[model samples]
Target: MTRSINEVRVVGLGKVGELVALLLSDSGFTVTAYDARTRSDLPFACKELDVRDGAALRSALTGADAVVSCLPYHLNLGVAEAAHDLGVHYFDLTEDVPTTNRVLELAGSGEARNVYAPQCGLAPGLIGIVGSWLAKQFDEIRSIELKVGALPRHPAGLLGYAFNWSAEGVVNEYLNDCEVLRSGRRQMVPAMTEQERVVIGGIELEASLTSGGLGTMCETYEGRVQRLDYKTMRYPGHFELMRFFFDELGLRDRRELAGEILVQAKPPVDDDVVYLHAAVEGHADATGERAYRKQYVRAYQPLTINGRHWRAISWTTAASAAAVVELVADGRLPQTGFIKQEDISFVDLLSTKNGALFGDLGKV
Candidate 1:
């Protein structure tokens, strides 16, 4: 039987981390927030501790039922290891493929006593869940496309974009190779290529190849689908500006410098919108002769929760992870194992209080 989770330690108190800690606390879980550089303005209990310090992390997680790592993608493996050692459930919002592989390795080991769930964020997390649910609706899946973007509600500047989430994460996805299934075979494709124009919510946008957004869908639908890919949506001209920097300026080779430059140039905006779009096409039923298409599209904005305003990205990312954690606590998910975002049922996820914030039930 799954044990009740009453306490949780949240690592990294950044924009998304702060919201995660606050939302978990609001949901009746005792939250202890930690960060390398602690903030005094956070709403819940917080402490100063570097997650790299294994001893300190274990200590912080001592009596907690779970530890949620909202740290940068590169800094999550150490926390996952610490969680394994302490026998506490491990969760993270990392989109880094290598880091997730390491977490998978840790969870697969016989010594692990708790669950390990990575990529529990916006794109790789909720997007994957919705994609998997749509795929299951078809009898012979032909193709699946997933696209998501956290864009400023009122875009400004030359790029027509603002840093809604992690600047480093944005750069990483642009530079890394994206995995996709083409013609019923899995393959790796260069990022920022295959640009296409799309329209969502009466707004025209552009999308292109990006890494880590597919999560495990490519593997899950490997031989089942003829085509499967995930892309990042952006306003028109955004892709050209990024290409000028990554290709023309040769900043792709210097990723850290690129990230620094981008962060320094673009200011983070609180008034942002999280846009999600997914479509699946295949045979509708056993007839295997009819083709049908199903799609999901929604735009989420900032919300007032408990007298405090939270950005769309902040709440969407944090709520995705928190909802999964709640599912585990309620014994709806496996108590001790490696959990994938695609393993979650869409109805179950949307039923959670935090997940319901997306609004419009049965619309998608």
Candidate 2:
């Protein structure tokens, strides 16, 4: 049985965590937030603990019905293991493949007491759901192209971007090989290759393969679609400058230093936009009589939540993770098992308590 979720815990109170706790609390869940350093500014119960210490993590999770990890990708695995051991439902915004795979393994271990729903934020979260929603409308699907970008609404500089998110996650996305379905087969493609021009809201931006945005869709739609891929959109010259910074400058080998230097150069911005585009081309009928193409394209800007304006990246990400937790809490999802974003109904997602905050999320 899916245990009733009441007392909830949120760890790593960073850019996205604070709002997550607020949203969940506003939706009526008793929220308690945690961090390595203490936090008192939030409107919820707060605690300080090192998640790496097993005793500390277990103690913190013992009384919670659920735990959401907003930590960096590297820290998610240990937190997930702790949650499973404590029989608490787990959710996260991790875009790292290995971390997700490990979570899946834990969920499938046959002793899991609750659901494990990772990849609960944007890109892999909402974008993947939008793609699956579109694909289901067609009798036969040919191609599904997914793209997302988070950038400053007003840009200045060669890179035309800001570090309003985790630099380590962005760096990892840029460096890792992306998975794609090419000609009805799954394959690994080098990231940053296959550059293409994408125009949304009358603004032209360049897009190229970035890792982890597709989540497990490559595995989900392997033989169903002729071609499936995901890319990250950015200002036209952004890719060139990044290549020059990472490859030409030989910073690829030093990912941590590269993230540090990049953050030092372009700090987080309050005025940012989150771009989403999902196009699905398929047959219009059961007999494959007609061809059809559709897309869910929008540019999300910051919006006010509880009288405070949030950055597009922060609120969109925060609401998505929290909304998924809401769904599980209400039993819209399985009580105990691994859940995929594609399995989520898009309409239900937009109708959740936190989903309203997320959909009120576009147009720069």
- lDDT top scorer: 2
Residue 122 alpha-carbon offset, candidate 1, angstroms: 0.5
Query: Which prediction has the highest TM-score against the true structure?
Result: 2
Per-residue lDDT of candidate 1, residues 1-364 (tens digit):
4347889999988888888888888877889999888778867888999777788878898999999999999899889988888899999998899998898899888956898999999889999999989988888889999999889989888787888778889998998999999999999999989999988878888999999998777888889999999999999999989999998998989988998888888888878888899999999865455888899888888877778898888888999998888888888888888998999988898887777765552132
**Every candidate's lDDT:** 0.87, 0.91
Model 2, position 315: C-alpha lDDT score: 89
RMSD of each: 1.9, 1.8
Compute the lDDT for candidate 1: 0.87
| Candidate 2 segments exceeding 4 Å error | 1-3, 286-289
Worst 10 residues of 2 by lDDT: 355-364
Q: What is the TM-score of each candidate against the true structure?
A: 0.96, 0.97
The per-candidate count of clashes, in order, stands at 0, 1
Q: How high a TM-score does candidate 1 get?
A: 0.96
